[model samples]
Target chain A: MQQENSVSKLKYFPVTAFSVVMGLSGLAILLYRAYHLGWLPLWAYLAAAFTALVVFAMFVFIYGLKAIWYFEEVKKEYNHKVKVNFFSAISISFLLVSVAFYGYLPFVSAGLWYAGVIAHLLLTFHTVVFWIRSEFEVHDINPAWFIPVVGNLIIPVVGVDLAPTWVNIYFFITGMFFWITLFAIVLYRLVFHKQLAEKFIPTMFIFIAPPAVIFISYFRMFLNVDVFSMSMLSLALFFLGLLVFLVKDFFRIRFYLSWWAYTFPVSALGIAMMIAYQATGFSVFKYIAVFVLVLTAAIVAAVMAFTVKNVVLGKICVMED
Target chain B: MKNVTVVVVYIFGLITGILATGFLINISAETVLLKEMASPYDFEKTVEVLAKRINSTKNWHVTAVIDQAAEVKGHGEGDIGKLKIVQYCSGKYAYEVLADDNRKKISVMMPKTFSVYEKNDGRVYIAVMNGSFVGKIFKGETYEILEKVSLEVEALLNFINFKFSLF
Candidate 1:
């Protein structure tokens, strides 16, 4: 009876839990890029990558159990207004893990890339259709909405090698179009509507991911630092700056699962800065890259600590109101 | 009013000085610390010739030939044309640099690199750190050794007829 009661808690496992994998995988990719820049040792990258893989496996196992035991709960989350957006985190996690491992295991990376691309595309289609069919208040809009769009942008990062150029371009264009459309809507909502609830505040960082990921994908495809790529990078930096300016608000918020939202976007920006430094050979970008990478590492460490604390306190994996 | 004018001028002058100094450092750092030259051979042949030359030299051995383009592609960063970094080291030079405990930090520059890459244009080029210039920065025994190393490395690339320029 005790074991069965404990196991029943699986029903409370939120789909947003997948964001933890996205955060860890993003940090893994950032560390990998830092290794190439000669700023960090190879072991650092390997450690982060290994940890991400382990965490990803754990999440998949637990979530799989949740899906099996509580299919109706999973369906409820799927139909949820904001929770539905995080399902794409599952796909983004796969793509990021594929990128994190691309340097060491090309074959395995290719398989993961294919799986990630296909799954993300299906999620994007589902999310978009659901958006069109459903009615949502302006207050329902949040930065999490960018999750599916950003996943599209990530396709070309690893997809540049796994798929044809046209296929990469297809995802890139779709991501870019939706990112802009959502940005306008999200911004309007933020300015005109009430502030986001404390639980969702950390997701303001997602504003940084789309442009940063777009910059990396664009640079990977063209291998040049032209106006368009620079613009994307600058926009990412601007969002990062805006978040830093609002650091007081972020500091006051209590820990929530959405805190994982702060991790990947910052890591994506760090990777983008490293790529900018590589493409342009500018020391300024190198300095910014180091700064952002250190910040990303710190953020991931803090979130992990908080997550562990919450799990031990029995605050996590509990039913939500 | 006169004091305020003076303060404004001082602030403006400081800003201008900082900007000018930054511009100068940026330009000088690139030119003073590196050398670039066009390679008569194609991209693959250029790396092959450079590796062979380094191997043939006395007391020098090619440590590694890193296919940077392949590495970048595998990392999925993007294609950077055909770029190869030919890393070579000399046991004698390594000993000389490391002989002094104080100068051990210079080992970071060891296993010296020669980057041979194809640009957007249909030409192959070789770029390496200007050892002579770097040696001059740490004048004395280190200078003499690095200057010799620089000359010897330049001699290894004699097959390339083009004049080396700090681009």
Candidate 2:
């Protein structure tokens, strides 16, 4: 009876939990760049990469068990509107970890990159088809809708070297097209519709990731600093500033697993700044890079601590209202 | 009433003067503190030649050559052109500066650096701090030592024909 009761809780293991891996892997890749710039010690990158890998494995193992034991429950999550979007987080975790290991382990990195690319492409297809077939109320559309789109943008960060140029470009163009379309829809939803729920408010930070990832991927492809790349970077910075301007609203909300949404986007912005500094050789960019790095570190640490606290208190992994 | 107007004018002038000074510093800081010259050889050859010359010089040793472009690429930021920083130090000069407690603070500038980079114009250039100009500001034994170091640095760089600087 005791074993059965404990096993029954597996049904509540939310698919959204994969987002923890996304956040950790993003930080690991950012620290890896900082390590190369001589801004951080090698141990910093190693620790972050190791932690991300371990946590990702743990989440995948647990979530896999949940799928096997509670197939119907897992199916319910996949069929849900908002919950389904986070499934792409699994593929994104693979791509980000692939980037973090690209320097030390090329073979492993290439394998993971292939898996991530194929998996993300499939997920993108499923998501688009789902959106077309289903009717979503305007209120149902939120920043979480951008997750699959953001995953596409992340492909070329490592895919440029591992895959053919045309393949990477294909992913880049697809991601850019969807990003613009979704940006307009999301903006319309925010301004014209009812406000997002409190739990979903942190997803607003998702606004920072697409353009920042686009900037990095664009720079990696062409290796140039042109007007288009700069505009993407500036747009990302503008959103970051706008979020900071409305920080009080964020502070008022209690912690939810969605808080993990704040981590990867901020990390992406910081990584973009580091790339900007390298491309332009501007001292101002370098200073901004360091500043964003420090801010990202603090945000990730705080979110992780809160996550651990909630897990210990049995506040997480329970049935939602 | 006249006295108050005079005070307001003086305050306005002082603020304007401070702003102008700050603007000037922002514009001139790089040129005043550093010097850049074109390198005849390509990026890799320039770094190799400088490292070989420094190692061959008396009492000087090449400490490290940092390939920043490779480093950036290795970490997945992609290439940012050819940028390398070469660090060299002389034990004799280091000891001369560090033997005194007061002069030890100058050790920050000890392992002198030379930045060899390729600009967008596809020309390779080498840049180093203007040690002599900086030394003159100190105006003491430090100035004498740095002045000598500057002349030796110029001599080591004589392989390139003197011409116009892109800086």
Which of the numbered candidates is closest to the native, going by highest TM-score? 1
Those runs of model 2 whose alpha carbons end farther than 4 Å from true positions after fitting are A1-5, B1-167
Clash number by candidate, in order: 0, 0
Model 2 / residue B86 / CA error / Å? 19
Lowest summed lDDT window (length 10), candidate 2 chain A: A102-111
Binned by DockQ into CAPRI classes (incorrect, acceptable, medium, high), candidate 1 is: incorrect
lDDT, candidate 2, A11-114, per-residue tens: 78888888888898889888977865657865798799989889888988788767656879888887788988998998988898888876445445656776
Measured with C-alpha atoms, the lDDT of residue A152 in candidate 2 is: 90
Model 1, position A197: C-alpha lDDT score: 91
Error of 2 at A79 (Å): 0.8
lDDT of 2 at A234: 93
Cα miss at A303, model 2 (Å)?
0.6
Can you give the lDDT of residue B61 in candidate 1? 91
Error of 1 at A130 (Å): 0.8
Candidate 1 local Cα displacement, residue B103, angstroms: 32
Candidate 1 structure quality by residue, lDDT tens digits, A17-126: 88998999899899977866557866788899889888888887788667656779888998888988999998888898889886545445556666688789999999
